[model samples]
Target: MALDKLIGLAMLAVASAVFTYYTIWVFVLPFVDESNILNSFFLPRDYAIKLPFLLLLIAGLGVGTFIGNVLIKKAEKEKLKKSKKSD
Candidate 1:
């Protein structure tokens, strides 16, 4: 249903946001002066702009989130169908 599709998209947005928020472990560290300072990202600066790696990061997260939400929706649909058929 249309509502199911929308729900799936919503789930994907939440998943991607959570992934980006938590996966930056290498980007922040304590400064030498014992103050809070942020470093660059996890990957090396030279590799950050490379098209392949950049695309891989974006595509991997996008595809993984999309597939996960779709699978959940499909399973829920099957469960509903089975319950209705038995009723």
Candidate 2:
């Protein structure tokens, strides 16, 4: 349960960071002059647009895999207990 909470918090932080970056890149940078130092950190418009979606997809896959593995292990443990009881 603690691990689950930790993973959830970590994912939340990552998602928040990505969303914030995407917002800044898409909404804030356009108004800044091309020569501004901050502009250098900004992604190209197309890639910036796609970044948050991609990050979300990746995070979803990772969380899904972690949960699946945990469920599989639990099933295996239950199976082991049943077999041991019959022995």
Candidate 3:
């Protein structure tokens, strides 16, 4: 619901989609001829592979930072709550 969560989810969705597409392109498309229409949907074979890898790396970093931020916020909130309780 929050913007942070929405952004995180979007990043995750994009990563998943890219990974799925790349998997199919690399593993399944090999069986299809280069002349097939399906081949046009993807980049040249090498770039296709490299691009997805890069996207995944970026998405992974985003997700990791998001989770870290959420954890840190939670910890900060708990610390504040405890300090108030003791005051």
**Lowest lDDT 10-residue stretch of candidate 1:** 26-35
Better model by lDDT, 1 or 2? 2
Point to the candidate with the largest TM-score.
Answer: 2
**Model 1 deviation from the true structure expressed as Cα RMSD, one decimal place:** 12.0
Clashing residue pairs in candidate 3 (N, C-alpha, C atoms within 3 angstroms) = none
Question: Residue by residue across 1-87, what tens digits does model 2's lDDT show?
Answer: 699999999999999997898789889988999899998887788887487689889999999999999999999999999999999
| Candidate 2 clash pair list | none
Q: Estimate each model's TM-score.
A: 0.41, 0.64, 0.53
Instruction: State the number of backbone clashes in model 3.
Output: 0
What C-alpha lDDT values do all the predictions have?
0.67, 0.90, 0.90
Model 1 agreement with the true structure over 1-87: per-residue lDDT tens digits:
699999999999998985674345323322222332444334443443485577888999999999999999999999999999999
Q: Choose 2 or 3, whichever is better by TM-score.
A: 2
**Per-residue accuracy of model 3 over 1-87 as CA lDDT, tens digit each:** 999999999999999997899898888988998889999888777886688689899999999999999999999999999999999
Candidate 3 ranges with C-alpha deviation above 4 Å: 1-42
- The local distance difference test score of model 2 is 0.90
TM-score of 2: 0.64
